[model samples]
Target: MNSFDKLYYENYHKVYRVALKMSGNAQNAMDIVQEVFLSLFDKLENGGEIIYPGTWLYKVTVNKCCDGLRKQMRFATLDVAAGNEFHEVTIEKQETRQIIEKALFELHPRERVIMVLYSEGFSYKEISEASGVKFQSVGKTISRILEKLEKKLKGLNNDLY
Candidate 1:
């Protein structure tokens, strides 16, 4: 196999899992994965070299997720403007995963992506590279996000986090 095929095979699962976690749905994850690989194919076709393929894929996946969320937000705004009443029903009794899912869904798209990357054991430097946040600021930003998550989650289950 050529080098591009080899890299795609080696990295596809990693990128997909990150996208899945970021998107919270398999359909969106698959779309983001396809988009990322399609972009990669174009880069390789144009004789462009990616120094860190994994990091680049992560960056692209997160950006695509953010784009999707932004589109959803815009649609929601338009729906509200059209006089549609959107009611979100909350579960009274929730499992740990459900609670965490709700908390993650409440976060802004950028924060949600960073939290997923961090939970997957991406280093601060790697997150900075993928997220385009200043390298030095990743820790502080993560700290704040974590505190927010903790505060929200602790109410659901004190021992589970």
Candidate 2:
């Protein structure tokens, strides 16, 4: 396999998972991943060098996901203004995974990306680089996000009781 092919094989799943978490839609995630790789391909085709391909892929993926989410939010708002009634689809029994996902989705897109990257075992510096957060603030932001999630999960659990 070629170098580009090897790079894709190594990073495809990681980028896809991050995209999926950020966008919360498989189709959107796939599209974002495709866009990111295409960007890398273009850069390489032009003889541009990337010292850290993984970090570059992650930054691009996060930016694309954020853009897509912003567009989606705008459409959702327009739909609401057009008298569309949003319906909440409740699972019969909320599994732990479902509950966690629910809370995660409630967070702002940037917060969600930061939390997801952290969970994926990216170091603070990696998360900062990927998510466009400052390195110094990644830890504090994470702590804040964790507290918010904790409260949200607690509230959700209480609702079930």
> What's the count of clashing pairs in each model shown?
0, 0
lDDT of 1 by residue, 28-82 (tens): 7888899999999999999999999988888988898889888887311111111
lDDT of each: 0.81, 0.82
* Candidate 2: tens digits of C-alpha lDDT, residues 20-116: 8777677777999999999999999999999999999998998887888787773111111111232343343435546777788878888988988
Best by lDDT: 2
Among the numbered candidates, top TM-score falls to: 2
lDDT of 2 at 6: 93
lDDT score, residue 152, model 2? 90
Which consecutive 10 residues in model 2 have the weakest lDDT in total?
A: 75-84
Task: Evaluate residue 14 in candidate 2 and report its C-alpha lDDT on the 0 to 100 scale.
Answer: 98
Question: Which residue pairs collide, candidate 2?
Answer: none
